[model samples]
Target: MVADREGGARRKPARAVAVYVAGGAVLLTGCASMPDNGDLRGVESTPRQDTQVRVFAMPPREDAQPSEIVQGFLEALTSDDPQYATAKQYLTGQAAKTWRPELSTMVLADGPATEADPAGVREDSVNFSFTLTGAKVAVVDAEQSYAPAQGSYSRQVRLVRDRKSGQWRINGLPQGVVMGKSDFQRNYTSVNKYYFASNSAVGTASQTAAVADPVYVRRRVDPMTQMVRSLLNGPTSWLGPVVRSSFPSGTALRKGAGPLTPDDQNKLTVPLNGKATQVGRAKCNEMAAQLLFTLQGLTPAVDEVEVQAGGEQLCELDEDGAAAVAARGSAKHPEFLYFIDGEHRLVRIPPGGSRSTNADAVPGELGGGERALRSAAVSRDEHTGAGVALDGKTLYVGSLVSGSSLGEPVVRSAGKTEDERLTTPSWDARGDLWVADRDPEHPRLLVLREGKGEPMEVQVPGLDGQIRSVRVAADGVRIALVVENDDKQSLLVGRIERTTKDVPGGKPGPGSGVSVFELRPAAPALEEVTTMSWAGDGRLVVVGREEGGVQQMKYVQVDGSTPEGPAPDALTGVKEIAAAEDGRLPLVAYSEDGIVRLPDGAQWQTVVKDGSAPVYPG
Candidate 1:
């Protein structure tokens, strides 16, 4: 068998290749290299994405030259060698011990261009150097999360001769391995880690909201086992403060357990240490639900997961059981699409969007003509909703049932002008309400508890711009804001950190406070982001414009990575856009032509000839 990556068992790569045994020929893997992030120019695009072929990296020859060793080492970095044992053969004793393939990954627009240093011809000649250069694309951090990066890439590898064998070996290299985007795509596969919302303070399984944290892992290696360890390790740093792992602290896989694999019924039993033996049935079910969600997309489909501790079965969760215990973001289906119709009243359309029926006003005063509304957001449960008055000065909340009257105004904006008032409201899965007051002098983001309590101003520490629109994610741990600054509008995603107040002394308080922090760009490359909505877990469909470009719509990950699917078809005069966390639902938008929806295998069709502000339940 071929030597795997790190320690001889990492058996996958970041990209793809092809080797035909019948023809006995070697060919380079052809993958697109055009930079979508506008990092640089001159990268040529390839024809197509060929088949997936496993590459076997060979050990260094007895008398390898310094140039040969440099090339081989770079190649080995792209292989799925278990533990990267084969790659370490080319490194000196000191370098081998210090090297860590799992530390991080640097990805470029194309395969790095390697060139030997001109100063290699010294008379003493104890060392040689090779410079690697390429256009930066993105980076997979030590946690395996991907983020878009920019600028030129360059690194140097210095080689030295072994004292005893006189063989060439690499003594110095960068902290993490580097590869082209194609290789990264071939070698690694993206997977989601599941965690519960910290906003609820460790509630029961039925009440808890599970959030997804996306990360990358090797495809050919023991990915299931690797993913289990990653899930057990907890959420990534960016999402750590807002989410909690169901797994108990210090809980880990049994020490002598072999690689985890699914049985004939697609049930994978995970053996945890004694730390998990004490959790009651509710907690154990939540833990099993997390495992089932995280490993469902991996190979050999895991339909069931069982948690075992100290040689005894703790709990078992199948698809239906998991759904009942911990509801996932994708399981949410939008029942109706809401928008402001020609009469300026809140109205609803059947969610399928392909129906030919006319729009109907929702129950309650907010949907009636007497109280004109401009924008609105329905709660996750669909039993309640919040709407902004036509003048944008008052925000109202009430029930969705028949004959239900709109309650008193929950929030009032002092902005004198229409443009300087409250933005649309949003609801999180936790049932909390969110909105932004654009009263230029006292601009602030506000949240109402359960859409009925006093409006609390959310502190955004690093937000230097005014929030024009707000959309809290279904998980409730993240919120997206369209922030306007210096005449440009950018889409930013922030963490919703909730902490209980500290008592006068050193004790914890029962009261909780919430704040938004880590406001990073979700669409950094766009010059102006007009509107956006959470398309799914860790994904967004944004309407924005690139520098010196026309308005366009594209999907982006919360971490600022490029999206996986094709871009949406172009629509003109898109003033606002909305999407459901359930990706299968058609995308709804309010363009110049009024309200429209995109159905499966169909172009944008008119939902209403005179409507604006289309939205699905959060």
Candidate 2:
């Protein structure tokens, strides 16, 4: 299976064997009649019973007033119940029926403050508004599209006394739920749902491409089930047109909305509706691959998955098999790191010291004398290389094999001077070369198919800034861009849509290959970004400084959320950063001291004394 670039939709690299525990402990009991012998005299044993407990918040009190009810409802939104049953109790009958918490979510600065004026209050009704004055951090809209929140938000709620029970209840309120930043942190966790590339051809020799759709799920809720159900529901609005799912239309959980349980063997049995029964074995296996990849993030990760339709077994896949079907196309570690060495030649450093240092210039004209490369990018397959000349006016592509000469310039910068010429080059998983000419007059973003075709201009709508750098995600559908406007650099993520027209009996015609993209603001948490690269699983490792601060290295989710895990090591003086889709590879960067890398749990190590423009195969 082909791995999708954006979702890091590749089979996970195989892991080392793990030891097993039975019921969380070892059992060593024997019959007393024979066990009392001297051989067991010194043995000590203890018998213990397993204990389990679950805690849940109590529902709103019956005597609570309108303000108190509103407060409780907002607090309940942070609970672990995915259905928000407790939160609904604070609403009036009609309000509860109309409220759609999933329609959108407002991530507020803090808990809301209720304003109930005496003049606005009647004997049976109270009119008040929840004044939410804090900055909105982010928003999840009705279409499940998550983006950085802008400006402020406020909501008003009116309470009416129930005629039958005399209880104060929320009668009028907003359509979505609102939670403080702290509550959102505690209640929500991000997970990626896997889907096949829209053009993936199943059952053929063609590779399968998988894309990842990241979304937030309720913490402590059954994330496994939520993720699977969300996957079956399909990709969100922005990604819907670029990806495909193996689950058939109308496919749903057979057992209704409930947590999917795994048996003692760690096998999750998913019972689907009848729609899944019609799929063939190969297709069913592909569906299983999606489930396994989505649920792999759960605690006590699922080792196998069993799919059933109408209580009949349809397919089963083990961890290894599922990984094989969704393999990200290559091993997690990169084959080598390529950079411009002191001798002005394209040199390589094999990851983990697998190859000799400063391996001879990638076996071609690029490795020969006077090439004078300024920047370079190696394709994921390591079969091709793209680079920019020292003058930055010409772009070259060449083979990485021994004795192969560099190809003539496929793209030439229109800039009148070298300083305003082309920026660094990047390669996508599809072997497309992307670069931008910095000449303000022309200022164009271009893509060269397979690094050798005619350069095609891609329209980036609403880009009021000059392009600084461009990196395409492995999925080949999204691009991470660093653009500068008014001397301030910003990081942005955009969707790449390829438009083509079918020919009578051939591939897409020349005039049909137009590239268009919609740019969206990303990494709003950072004020200025210098360099960025696509980290595995749709995340980015960025080098930038916060407002009025020094530069630091941090990881940001594609949706603009600051992830909850530990931040990566902070490295200073970084000029460029490159990462492989398989995260096992260390992060390679060009620093003041030279080419440096940060391996997992280790400090930065210098690979070469003088090198620049370090890059890993995409």
Candidate 3:
């Protein structure tokens, strides 16, 4: 899903997982076991004695050994240490196996200081809600900072724990957050190519923090008493606050304060014997088509397509061919349309066109727009507008006019006043222009093809509300627009009549292609779908917050089936998601927080923090 390039989405990747528990150990100790009732068919029919096994909660051992179970897990994950051998002293059963070979490794680590550090604790409880027998420990965060040449580094750690077995054992860990490949391509790549320093990657935590925290970089951290007090007293203070809040109030409490949710990062070694195939140029072309086609399919169709439009054999499909594309609405095809290739570099046309041709030339069609879009002179109103596909040819953009007069050449404003509120400009591949006026009350999405002066307006019944979001398939036949009604929870999906020009029923026959589906229960009430985009094959990616503080990102497949329920991995690990522009793999997830990326996951350079939510074009 793509975020607005101008203002980055604001969110703090969740710091740590929250674990809650109720009923103290004393309450559990006196509990009794009961047999099933005869009337209940699901329950066991046998009647047993009302008896109980009382297990009392034990106090923390004063002489408990300092087991480095949590720290060992973090070290093994971060610096390629063989500390997994030492982890068994603490972990047991399936947890031992899960911790054995780190599923994926993280590049850095952050946690509480070790025993050697000045502020370090000798030992502590690992679980956040431990009783006398069972303990649960979790890693909160792990971060590392390296010196030049990737030599030595300092690491920080945070952990949480619950009382258990009169002891603490570390349980879960934290995940890293990063950008998706498509997002990197569209927003950061080449955009900041000049600002990056040699030997340093841009958009990384260290680099971005270097720029973001100017004061911290310029000045030394003075060891002042007030600073110490703030660390111990202030709201943002990590150490002091955690100790006071997490540690048990009684003598059972040990040195450890909170559950340390260390980053559980590990990497696996795999052998790749085959030579990698070279499809760089072909791949780039597919990516461009996917991105542009989706936009064109949305509103009024533009006249021409642009995106390195110089390569001669670039793929092309006429208007009729585009409408034939259909999605069965299955899990694979959650939406009606989508892009095959989602991420690729877009090199704007140079003032002088290139003289190259054939196989020797670049794959993208860079120079075919009817009129060149001026980079410096493009309209500036802060509202970032993108080109939309209509009828497989023309591109449509809402035009900006200084005046509201309904001139013959200029599309008239839909507003009652003479104010220049709206105008639709249609352009062809060669940059040829056609202006069409839209109905003020019921605005139409115009589909313009070359030589087709009269544009097509696809019908959207029951669309009497403000448009909250819009997504157009890579092909022009399908369009999805989210409209917010007075109830705010309303979300509906509709198919457009690409074959006919009908309000309800018109032309040779009202196109059966368009049908609006109810998207209310699937989506939350009053929550907006902020980032909406289409993947190749018509998968719908919708990211937004729900009413119950649930931040959701879901996909609707165009194959005509409901998607599977989201698993733990999909919910917590998804950093960024992009559609492959080359169509090799329609979907690509960026960084998976703490879980190491899959061996086959797409390659991407690390991104520094610039306060923007990751962008995924496809």
Best by TM-score: 1
Over the stretch 272-334, how does candidate 1's per-residue lDDT look in tens digits?
999899999999999999999889856547999999999999999999988887676677787
Preferred candidate (lDDT higher): 1 or 3: 1
Per-residue lDDT of candidate 2, residues 1-618 (tens digit)? 000111121212111112223544322211212210011011111112222211133365666555455545655565445576767888887888999998887776544434444444356553443443445778877655567887767556666777778777778888887765655665667777878776632122345666777888766567678777788888987777778888999999986745787889989989998988889888898999888878875455588899999889999998777766664432346678888988777878776633245555777777675588888888877888888898899989998887887757988887988868998888776677899999989898999767876788888878879888888877777788988888888898887777766578645566665454667766776678889988876788999988898999888877788777777787779988877777778888888878888888788887777888888876
Query: Of the candidates numbered 1 and 3, which has the greater TM-score value?
Result: 1
RMSD of each: 6.5, 12.8, 25.0
Deviation in angstroms for 41 in model 3?
A: 10
- Which has the higher TM-score value, candidate number 2 or candidate number 3? 2
TM-score of model number 1: 0.88
- Backbone clash tally (model 2): 10
- By how many angstroms RMSD does model 1 differ from the true structure? 6.5
Those runs of model 3 whose alpha carbons end farther than 4 Å from true positions after fitting are: 1-442, 449-452, 474-477, 487-491, 498-526, 536-538, 558-562, 565-618
Q: How far does residue 451 in candidate 2 sit from its true spot (Å)?
A: 1.3
TM-score, each model?
A: 0.88, 0.86, 0.28
lDDT tens digits by residue: candidate 3, 270-347: 111112112244332332232222323221332222222222332333222322221111112111111111121111
The better candidate by TM-score, 1 or 2, is 1
Give the C-alpha miss distance for residue 292 in model 1, angstroms.
0.8
